[model samples]
Target: MGKDAKRSELGQFLKARRAGLTPADVGLPTDGTHRRVPGLRREEVAQLASMSVQYYTRVEQGRLQASAPVLATLADVLHLDDDQRTYLLELAGKQTPRRPRARAQQVNPQTQRLLDALDAPAIVLGRRMDILAWNPLAAALLTDFSQLTEKQRNYARLVFSDSEMKRRYAGWERVAADCVAFLRMEAARRPGDPRLRELVGELSIEDPHFRQWWAAHDVAAQTVGTKKLLHPLVGELTLDWETFASTTDPDQQLVVWTAAPGTASEENLAFLASWVTTHSPGEADDADARADPHAGRGTPPAS
Candidate 1:
């Protein structure tokens, strides 16, 4: 058997999922019921899963281990999707398997070369959405990674901690939610990752939206997406991004962005690159230039 995950984590995941649903959501008749809590009661969940209230309660309390079938039934009753169900099982330390070891934010030279060869903006992300590395075009397209400290160089921090990010994206909520969802997925995958936990804890305490969104237990493994940026210099830019996982190292991801040919977005990118080359300080490829230090963006308090 794999290393046992914290029973409390399983309990929290189940409670979060349960809180996101109501009687009406599961086709149960609602007769103007006044409930203290926001979602289905423990008894309701037990009834839906055909389990004893005591057993379900014990499972939720992390006092008892949830067998595979019990976990599956609970997942079904909770209406967990593929990614969420996987996360559920991982949290329970049931059928799901985990990587032998967690990885750090180190990229391959060949991968870096490939990233540099791309004309479009690109970033290499770690398991927790950390900005492991980024190319010149990426720096030009987004905030310069070098300008940020390690803790600030994260999607969640950038999306919630920085006001600039809100003005940067056209659909800030959707994108920020996606970022939160992705972090949730990683949380289950790396339940014991200290850095990942610190990232979540920091966001949870500092950002109210992050705290609420995290409690919803949403999970996402989006490989491709679109981001409409209201770029300050070049105006609006519509870019499509693709994430490629390394064949050699699953911990690292290569995310590349591109705009459709003949679109103004593409022209904007070209002009942006030229501006970066001509006006920006330091080497285009070097992770050096600019300064944007902000408070409360440091690493999570030492655990």
Candidate 2:
């Protein structure tokens, strides 16, 4: 569907959901006085969603793009079911229905545990390609994420801004192009996300390469692939990569890098793991701090 039509449909859906809900249904005090409209009023919905009545009115009129959190809040206030909640997010151009307390960059404990358990390189990525968390192997394979500032931890930013990343990836142009395409896909899903816009804006200004690729209008979903990297420690290595989406939070993905058993790449990975184990713990940490001077700074909210 066209963007305008989709927005209008989203507005209609919101209105319909609101109309089906009564003040009592949402735990609001109700009087028996005659009402001009059915269900909760616009101001009531705004109040429940913690937004301004004028803003809500503009959203219902299809004149504003509602953020994922706002749509999720409205869905809850309107008592929407799971399917309805998904629909609400889809209509709002969001990849997933965000819970009120859910932060896009926060990885669940279970996911973190899984990352820690992995023998190979693994990283958790948000919808905006921000590196939320990474395993020790991931740190060994790529740059140590903890050493980079949160803003610098993003895949797109590293691909464009870090000269070391360009040198690490053997197919730099192809990898950089794919990152741009995947970002384009994310842009379509969350068009109203200010963080995404900011990331794109910063990249466009900083890198002419990013500007050219973004203007190509390419769009791609992250999936299984093979990446050839020239790691400083492990030397040239080809690893198979797979992306798995989180069932609970569709915006979160676990990207794993592994090598085929009995291959030279596998042996190299094993060697790298052993090297990391034998090295002084403080050495890696110190190296990371030196690599990126601005480490430990928090990232901006992805929403």
Candidate 3:
């Protein structure tokens, strides 16, 4: 649907739902006078949602883009059911049909085992592009996932915010553009995701390049691709990468970077693996941390 039409529909839905509710129904004390309009007032909804009346009015008038947290709060205040909540999100252009919430950052035990068995660098990615888990080789090839804080583990954030990332990739522009496009696709699929919104907001302010690319409204999915990575220890390596959707959790993906057998890239990858083993036992501990099977999921807010 067109953005304006969808927003109009959203406004109408909000107004209709508001008209059907009463102050007492939502635990609010109603004035004992005869009312002019039906249902709870806009001020009441704004109060319930812990937002200003002007903001709520603008939302009901289709003049503002409601964030995911705001929508969730509104859903609660309005006592919306699952279907109605879904409908509200869809109307606000926040979610799509059958799109689940972003996956937690905990990799399952079996998945961790599979990651450890992989010969190439393999990492699991959450829906919002967070590095949920990575093998030791992955830590060597990419950044050490273990060393990064939970918020810093996001691929898009690293692409735009970390200066070292630009030097690490031979085709920096292509890689950054692709990451931005993939993030755009994710935003479209889950507009109410506060963490995703936060990532975008931070990148937009911090990186003008990201702001321009994001405004272009390009959308792409991350799948099989090749990347030219300049490992500090080893020279340049051209690696073919593939992404596999997790069978158990659709929101999680397994990303593996490999080189063709007998190629220089393969030798370089082997060298990197060996280098990781010899240089960083602490990194190996990070890999073992991934196997804990009880790591808590870290949730960063969007707003």
Candidate 4:
């Protein structure tokens, strides 16, 4: 959608969510008298958010563009949870889609070499979260994306559409939200990429949860975090994760996973790494390699 349309939609969403809250919910006094509006007064919101009443009114009217920090402050004052916070930011045009520069025709050989050298699981992801390249260790640590067809290599798509993702990650909800947030940020960065639009369309149709999450319009920058993986062969693993921007392809990112030293989860990750190397395909150069290898291998991709 165009920025204006998106802003209007976001504004409506914020108003609806805000109106649903009662003053007492946030520990404010409610007179219990007849009311024209359901929520706190605009002045009350402006005071709490450290904004002027006129400016807050302009924002609610969709006539002002708010800065990121200001929107964040307003979200906090509004008692917005993650989803609501995202919605507020989007409404203020803080998360508009971006126009990406043209992509290179070929992946860099040096990048491939770097992936091959990592003992920790690491994959090179396109701006839209496509699994552009991964090493054997990376394949072992997570799902074997290198074995998938070109069309099936997207991480965001897999999380939303593939059932296996739910089973593979114990903290699927948080992971899913973060994935959505990342994609939202990417959308702002590369708004013109047709592939990104297609991925969003596909996910919106295939998954109800994705449809709900997409409405929030959240965006997140890459940072170190933790993830829990339930490997079919090796049990559970809690891994520390980091993401780095590719120097050659700044739009793409390298996501790496490592477990804490001397932990049982680290040991489990070690076992799973060995398991993926032997079973997952080293590359996707043929139809046979791209075919669904998970057939009868495990439960239907999460559920």
Say which candidate scores most in TM-score.
Answer: 3
Alpha carbon RMSD to native, model 1: 10.5
Each candidate's TM vs. the true structure?
A: 0.62, 0.61, 0.62, 0.59
Sorted on TM-score, highest at the top, how do the candidates line up? 3, 1, 2, 4
**Candidate 1 lDDT tens digits, 82-109:** 5777777776766765334543558889
Separate clash counts for every candidate: 0, 0, 1, 6
- Residue 64 of model 2 has an lDDT of 98
Return the candidate ranking by lDDT, descending: 2, 3, 1, 4
Judging by TM-score, tell me the better candidate of 2 and 3.
Answer: 3
- Candidate number that wins on lDDT, 1 or 3: 3
Whole-model Cα lDDT per candidate?
A: 0.74, 0.77, 0.76, 0.68
Q: Whole-model lDDT for model 2 versus the true structure?
A: 0.77
| TM-score of candidate 2 against the unseen true structure | 0.61
Q: Write the per-residue lDDT of candidate 4 for residues 20-88, one digit (tens) a residue.
A: 544532334445588788776777778767789999887777777778888777665555555556566
lDDT of 3 at 118: 85
Taking every candidate in turn, the Cα RMSD to the unseen true structure, in Å, is: 10.5, 15.5, 14.8, 11.1
